[model samples]
Each structure stands twice: as C-alpha cells, then as structure tokens.
Target: MVSITFLGTGGGRFATIYQTRSTGGMLIEDRGRIHLDPGPGALTNMARLNMDPGFTDAVLISHCHPDHYSDAEVLIEGMTRGGINTRGLLAGSVSTIDGIDGIRPAISDYHRQLPSRVLSMRAGDEADIAGMRTRFTPTRHTDASGVGAVFETSAGTVSYMGDTAPREEVTASHEGCRVLILNVTRPFGARLRCHLCSEDVPAIVERLRPELTVLTHMGVKMVEQGPEEQALRLERMTGSRIVAARDMMRLDIGDSLRVNAPTLL
Candidate 1:
C-alpha cells in the first residue's frame, strides 16, 4: 500500500505568513519515505506527529519558493543524522538546486553535501527515487525551471502538479495517474499568473479524469472562501472525486483509495 500524509495545505505569501493552513508539505511512504516540498511548518509538524525526519530517504523540492523549500535544509540535516552520515537523496529543480537567473539556491552548499546524491532535475528527466520510478514533469510557473513529478508506486501512479498555471503540457504529463495533487493557490474568479485557481480545475479534471483529484496549497482567499466549498463546486463541474486536502490528512492507496481525516495536534 502507498500512503500519503499531507503536512500542510496552505500556500501563497499571505496564507503562509498567517498560516491559515499549515505549510509543511506531504510525506509519501512506499518503498521508502519521501518528504515532498517541506516548507515552514514541516519540521515542527513532523515532530508533532512523531515522524522522524531521520527516516526520510529523500527530500524533494518542486521549486525555489520559500513556501515549497523553507524547511529543506533542516530536514536534510535530520536525514544525514546531523551531518554525521552521508545518506539519502536530495532532488530539486534547477532553480531550487543551482539558482536560475538571479534567484539564489534554496539549499546551502554545506547542506547539499550532506545528501549522498543530489540530482538537479529538469522536465522529462527520469530517476529512481526511493525504489520508485519518478519522472520530472514541466510546469508553467514564474520559476521557469520549476517542475512537477509523477511517481510510479506499487499501487499506482501518483502525480504532483507543482505550482503551475493550467497548461496543456501540464495535463498531458500527468495523464493516467491514479491520484493527482494540485497546488491550487487561488479561489474561484481569483486566477493569477503562475498559479492554479479553483476555476481552472474542471477542464484539467475532464482531460485526465484521474480516480482522485486533490486540491491543496490554498491561498488566503481560497482559505477564506473555503477549500471544501470550492472542491464541491469543482466536483460538480468535473464529475470526479475532488477532495480539498487539510493539513495532516492521510490518503491510503491500495485496492481502493481511502481518505483519513486530519487529526489536528
């Protein structure tokens, strides 16, 4: 079975600052544990849940945005046992790993050396991560080099659509996945450049028609308007199972996908 635990659900500048929802990212447990896009509350939330960062086999950052990579260095320290051991894989976009344009790298050089292997990923790149076949997918975001990912797990394919605007390539890259995770940072009628809005979901869902579509990484407006209500409206329009993920919610994928409600700490 493949299990995914959502550590945080909030995104955007204000939402992260105010913490309308947590910004810890998600944890995937399959062949090995992977913490994806660990942001501000990632380490704290992991401690709250008694999840040892030392067990994390890999840490993946989709982009260089602080909301996506803030806690990465600290987590790398944990993964390497306070830098006492060189273990685990560290993967991120070119922008996140090497700094594209004028943007600075998210991880420091010291932290970079801690991971046994550091992969600078680009769209269409394929890698074996934590015993799963992973593909880097393209994204139309402010960070030109930013990428999403598709993981071929034992149960099925799980795709993470990183902070991206609705684009044909984005949909095409994630086709046929059993579970689709979207970083929806805007509410209905509040679309913005480089981010997914509630209004943009129907068409994407119609095209891919995955078994489950998860809405997460909500902005302040989305949080105020309510993610659940937006998800419900999108589900009606798309005729698919669309869930608005809450911080700490878990999804177990096996013969069937089971959503375990969040238990706030």
Candidate 2:
C-alpha cells in the first residue's frame, strides 16, 4: 500500500514568511519513506507529528526556493544518521543540485556527499529509486531549472505538479497518474505568473483526469478564501474529486484513494 502525508500546505512569499501555513512538504510511504520538498519547518513538523526523519530513504527537491528546500540538508543529516551512514537518494533539478542563473544550489557539497546517490534531473529525465520509477516533468517557474515530478509506485502513479504555472506540458506529463497533487497558490481569478490559481484547476483536471486531485501549497489569498470552498468550486467546474491539503493530512492509495484526516483517524 502507498500513503501520503502532508507536513505543510502553505506556499508563496507572504504565507511562508508569516507561516500562515507550514511550508514543510509531503511524505510518501511505501517500500520506504520518501520526503518531498522538506521546506521550512520540515523537521519541526515531522517531529511534532512523530515522523522519524532518520528512516527516510529518499529526499526529492523540485526547486531551490527556500520555501521548498530550506530544511533539506537537515533531513539529509537525519537520513544519514548525522553523516554516520552514507545512505539515501537525493534527487532534484539542475538548480537544486548545481546553482543555476544566480540561484544558489539548495543542497551543499557536504550534504550531497552523504547521500548514496545524487541525481541531477531535467525535464524528460527518469530515475529508478528502490523499484519506483520517477519521471521529471516540465514547469514554468521563476526558477527556470525547476521541474515537476511523477512517481510510478506500487499503488499507482502519483504526480506532484511542483510550483508551476498552468502549462500544457505539465498536464500532459502527469496524464497517467492516479493521484495528482497541485500547488494551487491562489483563488479563482487571481492569476499569478508561475503559480497556479483556482481558475486553472478545471482545465488541468480535465486534461489529466486523475482519480484524485489534491490542491496544496496554498498562498495567503487561497487560505483567506478557504481552500475547502475553492476545492468544491473546482470539483463543480471539472467534475473531478478535489480536496485541499491540510498539514498532517494522510491519504492511503490503493485501487482507490482513501483520505484519513488526522483528527478523525
């Protein structure tokens, strides 16, 4: 079985600065634990939720933005037992692996040395990590080197649209995923460059038609407008199963995805 846990759901500058929502990303549990993004408060959030960073087998960073990769190195240390054991895979984009266009590399040389394998990926690239096939997908973002990710796991194909503006390539790349996670940072009609707004969800959902669509990485405006209401709006517009991600929200994916709210579960 495959399960996903959202450690944080906040996105954009203001939300991250004030922490209107947490920036720590999501955790995927299957054959092993895989931490995605590990942004600010990742370790703290994980600790609060009783998640052990030391057991993480892989860390996937989609970009170099502080809100996405700030806590990566610390997690790397946890995964490697404070450098005692050099084990775990670190996969990320060119900008994240090697500084690009003046954006500093997110992972330092010291941390890079600790991971058993460090994969510098680009759009169309694919990597096989512990039996799961991960394919890099294109993105339109300020960080030109940023890319989305799709994982073909035992349960099904899980796609993360990283931080990107709505693009045909993004939709097409995530076509076969059973679970699609999008970083929808704004409410409908509040379009922003390089980030998704609720207005863009319907088309993307229609194009990909994933069994489950999760909206996450919400900005201040999205939070103020109510992510759940926005999700319902998107569902009505696209006839797709849509849910707004909340911190620590978990979902078990099998033939069908089952959402397990922390309070309820």
Candidate number with greatest lDDT = 1
List per-candidate RMSD values in Å.
0.7, 1.4
lDDT of 2 by residue, 1-265 (tens): 9999898999999999999999999899888888999889889988888878999999999998989999999999999999899899999999999989898889999999999999999999999855578899999999988999999889989999999988887788898889999999999878889999999998998988999999999999999999999999889888899999988899999877899886321
Give the clashing pairs for model 2. Answer: none
How big is the RMSD of model 1?
0.7
Model 2 lDDT-worst window of ten = 256-265
lDDT of each residue in 1-265, candidate 1, tens digit only: 9999999999989999988889999999999999999999999999988899999999999999999999999999999999999999999999989999999999999999999999999999999898889999999999999999999999999999999999998989999999999999998988888899998898899999999999999999999998999999999888899999999999999999999998775
